[model samples]
Target chain A: MAEALNKAGSYFIGLVRVIVMRILIAEDDLDSQTLLKVILQKEGHEIVTADNGLAAWEKFQQEDIHLLITDWVMPEMSGLDLCKKIRAQKTSEAVYIIMVTAKEEKQDLITAIDAGANDYITKPYDKGELIARVRSGERMVSLEQELINKNKEIYSEKEKSEQLLLSIFPRFIVERLKQGEVVADSCPDVTVLFADINNFANIFSRKEPVELVEILGQLFSVFDRLVSAHGLEKIKTIGDTYMAVGGIRKIRRL
Target chain B: MDSNEKEKIVVSVDPDFEEIIPGFLEHRREDIKKILEALDGNDFEGIRIIGHTMKGVGGGYGFDAISDIGRFIEAAAKENRPEDIRQHTEELASYIDRVEVVYE
Candidate 1:
C-alpha cells in the first residue's frame, strides 16, 4: 500500500513538472487554423492561433513562442509583414518562422525570403508533408538554437582564454602575434618600464581585502590611462607590478 | 488557392492582430506544459537547465512573459530550495496561463 501510494504520488508530481515548448500559429484561414491546432495538439504541442498577420504579431509579442507557423496572406497584415516586424525588433532573438502560402511564384519566394521567413511551404500541403515540414522545422530550429548556444559559449570561452593569455604575456607580444609578428625578428633599442607599487604588502595587510582590491583597481586604471596617453605599449601586470615598453618611435628620452 | 482572390491581394502596412492570437496562445500552452512536467518530476536539475536555456531564447522570439517566468524558475532552482522549487513551478504555470501576448 505504501509503495503504491508513493508511486502514485510520484507520478502525480511528475505530471506537474512537464516542460512544454510554446508554438505560435498565424493563419487567416479558419480551416487551416483548425487543422493546425488539431495537428499540433495530436503531437502533444500546445498551439496559439492568429487569424491575421497583425494578430499573429500581437500574439508573438505577448506569448512565449518557440516556433511560428504562419500563412502568407490574410486581412490587415501578411506573414511577410509579420516576419519583417519580428526581425526588426532591436533585441530580437531568432524566431523560427515558416511561411505557408498558396502563392509560389519565384517572386513570391524572393519576397518571403527578404522578409525573413525561415522556410516556405505551399498550401494544399500533404498531411505527411506538413508534419515532416514541422518536424524539419523543429529539427532545424533545435539545431540552429544549438549552434547559437554553442557559438555564444565558444565566444565567451575565447574571450576568457584571451584574458588568461593576456595575463600571462605582454599585450604587445600578444598583439604582434595576433597581427602575425614573429619572435625571431627583434626591434632595436626597445625601452621597457617596470613599475611596482610601493610597500604593497604593508598597505595590503593594513586594509580590508575589498579596499585592497579597489585600490589596486584604481591604480591599474591610472596606469592604463597613462600608458595610452603616452602612446606606450602595456606588456603585462605581475602582482602589484605593471610593465610597459616604448621607444619604437625614435624618442631620445625614456 | 482562389485565382479571383489572388488578383485583389495587395499587402497592407498595418497587419491584422486578431487572426494570430489564438494560435499564439495555443502554442504557449504547449510549451509551458512541457516545462512544468520537467519541473514536477523533481527534475530541478532539468528545470534549471531547460529554464535557463529558454530564458536566453524567449526574448528573441517575443515571448517576454515566458522568459520572465523562466528567469524566476532558474533563480529558484539555482538556490536549491525544495519549497521554492515547488513554488516557482506553480508560478510558472500560472504565468503561462494568464500571459497576454501583444504586438506594438
Candidate 2:
C-alpha cells in the first residue's frame, strides 16, 4: 500500500510537470534554425524561429517565451545585446537563455555569462550536448517557477497561522506575543463577566454525549458573537462557563 | 562546368527541413548579395556582420563549408583584409549556389 501511494504521488508530480514551454530560437542561418527547431520540437517544446536578434526580441514581447536559444551574431542585434535587454525587463518570471555560438574564445564565453545567459553551447555542437544544455535551461526555468509557487504557499500558510493566532488572543496581545513581550497587565476600568449554563448536569444525563456537545457548541458560539459585537474580549470558555471582560482600559478612569 | 552540372552539391537534412530550407536559401542569397555590395564599398563592418552570423549558424544546418568561410571572413574583416574578405565571400557564394538540400 505504501509503495502504491508513493507511485501515485510521483505520477501526480509527473502530471504537473507536463508544462510545455514556448522556446524561441534566434539564429540567422537556415541550417541552424531548422536544426534547433527539429531537435527541440522532438523534445515536445513549441519552437518559434527568428532570423535575427531584433526579430527574436519582438517575438519575446508578443509571446510568452519561457526559454531562448540564441546565436551570438546577427544583423540588427547580437545575442549578448538581446540577453541584456531581456534581463533589464521587469518581468515576474525569469526567461532562461542559452547562448549557442561558434566563438570559442574564453573572453566571449565570459561576455555571454556577464550578459545574463543562463547557460552556453558552443558551435559544431553535438546533438546530445545541445539537448542536454536545453534540458539544463528547462530545469532552471522550472526550478524558479517551483520557488515562486513555494513562496506563495508559504505566504498563505503564514496568513492562516496568523488567523489561528487571532482566534485565540486579542490583536494587541497577539502582536505583543509576536514581539516576545509578556502580557500580564492590571486594568482598573475592566468589567469581568462570567456565566454558566444552568441545570447542566440534568441536561447532560438526558442527552447523548454528541448531542450535548453540539448544543454546548451552538450556545457558546452565540455568546462569543454577542461578546464580540459589544467590543468585549472573551477570556475563555470552561466547559459550561463563558468568561468575558469589557471596558478593558490600560489607564484608570479620571 | 555548365549551369546544370554546377548545381550538384546535395546536402541531406532532417524531414522538417522542407519547411525551412526554402526561406533559408533565400536568406543566404540575400547575404551573398549584401557581402558583394559591402565588398564594393569597402565596408569591413558589413562584411564582419555577415561573417559572424554565418560562423554562428552554418554548421548546425550541415554546411560546415559556409562556417569555415565565415570564420575566415570574420578574421579577415577584423584585420581589414579586403582581398581575403572578397575571396571568402566568393567561396561562400559558390557553396550556396551549388548546394542542394535533400530532406530525409
Candidate 3:
C-alpha cells in the first residue's frame, strides 16, 4: 500500500510543482516550437519538444508526461489521435492535454474536445492566455497531489499507532480497546513457567543473599534470552523463581 | 533597390526570443521558393502545407501580418486561385524585406 501510494503521489507532484514546471510541446513548425519553448523556459520550466505527432507519441510512450501541449495537424498522426491514445492507456496518472492549432472552426473545437483534449487554443494565440492555462492546470494537479500526500501521512500515522499499541498490550486486548470495550478477557492456552536455580539451598548456605542475587541475575538473563527467542511473554521474577507465559497475546506450540 | 526598400520598420518582440528571429525569417524565405515551385507543378497539397505552417507560426512571433498572408495563401490554394497565391507570396516577400525586429 505504501509503495503504490508513493508511486501515485510522485506521478502528480512530478507533473506540476510550484517552483519548477515540467512541460512537453508538440509543434511541427520550428518557429512556433522555438517561441513556445522560450516562453516556458523564461518561466523556469524544463521542456521537451517533438516536431510531429508520431514523434510526440513515441516520447510519451517512453515516459510519463502528465502535461502536454500539441498541434492539431501533423504528418503520421493528428493531435486528436494522440489524445485518444493517451486516454486509452490504463494508468493511475492524470493527463492534461492542450490542443494548439489553426483549426478555429466551431466544429474543430468540439471535435478536439470530444477526442479527449482537455483544452483548445486557436492559432495566433495570446501569450498571456497560454501561460494562464498552464498555471491553472498546474494548480489543479498541485491541489490533488497535496490531498494524496495528506492521506499518505494519515496512513503512516495509523500504522505507527498500531505498532506502538501492539508492543505494550496483547492483540485481543488491543482489539477490545479499539472497539472501546473494557479490555478484560481470558487468555487461553498460556503456559506459566516458574523456574528456580539448581542447588538452591546449598548455594544459599555457601553464599550471602546479596551474592545469591548476583547468581539469580545471571540465571534470569539466560531465561530472558529464551523468552524472546520462543516468543513468550515474561510476567515477573520473584525471589528465586522466574515466571513467564506463552499464548497470551500470540499463540505458540510449547 | 526601391526608394522604400531601406525604410526601417520596427517590430517589438520579447528580447528572450531575439536569437530565433533570424532562423524564422530564413525559413520564410525558403517557403517563398517552395511556393513558387509548388505553383509550377500545380501541387495544391504542397502549397497548402507551407501555408498552414506559416499561419501556425507567424502570429506567435508577433508577426500578425505574416499570419494574415499565410491564412490568405492557404484559403487561395484551397479555392485554386493561383493569382491570389502569387499576390500573397509577393506580400510575404515584401513583409520580410521591411520587418525590423526591435526586441523589447
**Every candidate's CA RMSD:** 22.7, 6.1, 8.5
Give the number of the best model, judged by DockQ.
3
Per-residue lDDT over A1-254 for candidate 2, one digit per residue giving the tens place of the 0 to 100 score? 12323311121244563456679999886677877888889887778999999999999999878899999977799999999999999987758999998889899989999999988888867667888888888788878877876888899998998888886777777777777877777776789999997888886888888998899899999998999899898877778898888987342121
Candidate order (TM-score): 2, 3, 1
Among all windows of ten consecutive residues in candidate 1 chain A, which has the lowest summed lDDT?
A2-11
Q: What is the TM-score of each candidate against the true structure?
A: 0.49, 0.72, 0.69
Q: Write the per-residue lDDT of candidate 3 for residues B1-104, one digit (tens) a residue.
A: 89375676678987877888899999999999999999999998889888988987888888888889999999999998889999999988988998889988
Q: Model 1: residues >4 Å from true position, as ranges?
A: A1-20, A57-65, A80-94, A101-129, A165-174, A183-185, A197-231, A249-254, B1-104
lDDT at A18 for candidate 2? 44
After superposition, candidate 3 runs with Cα above 4 Å error? A1-17, A151-254, B1-8
Fraction of native Cα contacts reproduced by each candidate: 0.00, 0.49, 0.83
The number of clashing residue pairs in each candidate reads 51, 1, 0
CAPRI level of candidate 2:
acceptable
lDDT of 2 by residue, B10-65 (tens): 88876645676677667778888898898889898888877887776676666777
